[model samples]
Target: MNSPHNPLDADTLRRLQEDVIDSYDEELELEVDDRILDGPAGLSDEARESRRVYFRELFRLQGELVKGGAIKRITQRLNPRVCRVAALPAPNDREKTQWYFQRFVSHLPAAGEIVLFDRSWYNRAGVERVMGFCSDEDLEEFFRSVPEFEKMLVRSGIRVIKYWFSISDEEQSARFLARINDPLKQWKLSPMDLESRRRWEDYTRAKEVMLERTHIPEAPWWVVQAVDKKRARLNCMHHLLAQFDYHEVEHQPVHLPPRERHEDYIRNPVPADMFVPDIY
Candidate 1:
């Protein structure tokens, strides 16, 4: 019988295997103790030597992972002022009365600013279409208007970059399962998210139609293979950075002035009741 999900590619399988191995290695590292190292109950000399080498390599690799924080520090140097807006909420009665594009206008970036819309006007093409939040006429209007809307933005000197994160059905299921099992992530699964999972094919079809209609020269859509989260983030960041010829700005050197101590200046003590317990 043919499987509903696509078969895992060799690359994906390798990644998964690596993830599993890492997880198991971490657990083993945590559980290691003096007894295990001492080769308890007459372990072979060769076996003991192999165990020592394995742990030595594992600890060395773990140290490298800790040092990987340097990559994050380097990326921080490229940080532009970013305004991240959460996904647009379901339209209220007032919003329904207004033109769909009107709400998005307020969230648009200023000349030198960058605004990231977690979910944008594409909701009309995806969720709104699949969930019947908008009528067929409304959806058609969005499809007709979006290309021109984007063209207008480009003409106004706003660089519009669009990304569609593509994940396989099987990978999505695994993610949903992980969220369900994880207490911290349970809040991410909304009723709409659950419903969308049920209508995956419908959403997929809507996405295809959206891409076909709205893909324009002014703002072409870039699809990111998102089944591997780390790779997806790195690829997305790399592609986004390549969009413009941005260079680091030269800044005047900053000098810190020494603090002046005034004879009359006195520090006040806080009341004991005002302090919170230092639980940590």
Candidate 2:
């Protein structure tokens, strides 16, 4: 028996609850990626041996951000989600005709939410310019307008922190070769990536111009030397945390309530065939 005002039925509510629990579980597994997540308050001897201090600090920063501390955490180094992969796909005919920044506007974070862009609108200055996807006029206009647009975003209470993860040619080459050899990483190799590698000089020129023209006081760029991925992650996270003034949240202690019980209730089990075989 559901009320008309309650839009979510029991089944729908159950599914939503399950989805949230599953997502939390998945987020927790990232702790294994950097063992420092166990306790940000203390750096154990094991953490020191594993060089987990960097990761621990990163997780701590993220926790502070979650607690409404004046911080925003965006992890990028070696993490594709922090880079170009998070950007929108190629513009369709209609999108191209609209305002250049229209598509990106929707992705902007609201108050207190930290929106991390893998590759931002600067794609026009970087990839699009180098790949000849945009005209010379388009490139010039983007360079001219981006500073003003960023200033507007900043004025609107948005913190526009830009980062350019710079890695060497030799390092990139080695990474590409490693990916080619590893079956697990084969999906990372795309025709566009291969083409980009060939046009390295063009990209370098575009990057230089983009940085020079769009580097405004309101939204300055921070270049991260990303030859060593781990160091880059640590350095970037540390820098971001330093830029903010954050304090730990004071929370009250929690007590678990006892579960309700019904003496007449009985639990039922499904048939053995309903279970999946555990080969492992």
Candidate 3:
């Protein structure tokens, strides 16, 4: 499909869906909507409210996994053997992303290779540039800084693995529609989404330039067929783990234990005068 307006038939849809799903982070999806919601002007009133409801429900579940303390290793969040999920948001820009990631990264319970899902950091590819979200000079500065940054990361004795998940205009629209139509997935949509959707070709052009400029021998963007999402994720995971030359990572050493002890640990009652609690 030359343009985003072009619709894909059912067969095309399935193949494209698989491609989109392939690029999924297994743990983090990192889509346009997420980037928009996290940064930029933000979402609309109704859409924001809708997203609030979705994230509340979604985080409640993710939080359950966290508080249950059933999962100790960070990778377990993505391990298909443990939690089989597809297409999640990667908050590289968020303090929580940077902080939690630092913690999660420091301790790898299992041995595995480290492969980058997105070969080139997305900020340069299409996300920051074409959208006018990032200034031209800022974009140039980022490009100049990336090589040295990556050089250091590579010298750390960590293998630099990068994968560029590419989707056609047809494929992107299909997934966008899927997000729009599916309520469970509706939170995936954002106001900036339509704006980006309109510029599929322009984005593609930027992606090409991004690859040309940034693809270094040390860490280059690997353009993968994104017509199928599962294929992309599995391929990415396989490549990533392979980098580590890892032996079998022990399954959750911390088992998903049944709720053992329960107590009414609710705020303990204090003496009447000792503590004057808030009077609602």
Candidate 4:
């Protein structure tokens, strides 16, 4: 295991390369290509020109999200349990018997913590509803109750901001195909995902219904145009940062305490066989 400060190893280098390739802005790529082909400028200059605006904006916006130096008691909760349940095994009989939102209630953020939900209870309105895992009555009930539930969350000082990432079918299909062809990403192409690809129209309809019914002033859904991954991430973060009125927090000067040392203290060495090979 390399230290965080160390340079990347072979596997890490390959992964980073792959990620860069995956997120390569095609629109930028075309512009750069056109400039290089038609103009007197070199590849580097054209490429730099294409990325300058976006990268500049992205970094500037990201700085805002990072620089809020505060310990303010704004509680936001992310339901990791819900995500685990979704990705892991099916809900057992007991879980099925419990009130649908009951499990989620415990995961709500306490005062001062921030809670975020990736899939959230809206799973009922999307995948579960589309896949026939949940009944029509359950679906209707979820739609009916979601607004009030969100309103209650707002009343309790939990700021709920929901975002739906939208991509065109052509972009989605291209992304799915990319995953299928890439051995490293193949695991992401599950049967459920493939099924969702087949039922694109169904998901769109479900999303429309969800937005219509659940669009409360307290917790309205924001749709992100996500065909471009880089733009989507930057745009979402920028939007989220804009939602808060933030000021830099004041802090007292820090003083490091002197380290205590004992002359008699000695560290022990491990056996040669105990050390793993430095393969990298």
lDDT of 1 by residue, 201-258 (tens): 9999999999999889889999989876545555665566567675556568999999
* lDDT per residue as tens, model 3, 56-155: 4334333333332011122344444433212234344663334222423432222233222321345544776887766787677666766776677677
- Taking all chains together, the TM-score of candidate 2 against the true structure is 0.75
Task: Name the lDDT of candidate 1.
Answer: 0.69
- Rate residue 8 of model 2 by lDDT: 51
Each model's C-alpha lDDT? 0.69, 0.69, 0.52, 0.67
What TM value does model 3 have?
Answer: 0.51
Count backbone clashes in candidate 4.
Answer: 9
In order of appearance, the predictions have TM-scores of 0.73, 0.75, 0.51, 0.75
Predicted candidate 4 versus true structure: per-residue lDDT over 23-91, tens digit per residue:
454334323422322222333565555456555555465446444400010111123332122222355
Cα lDDT for residue 9, candidate 1: 56
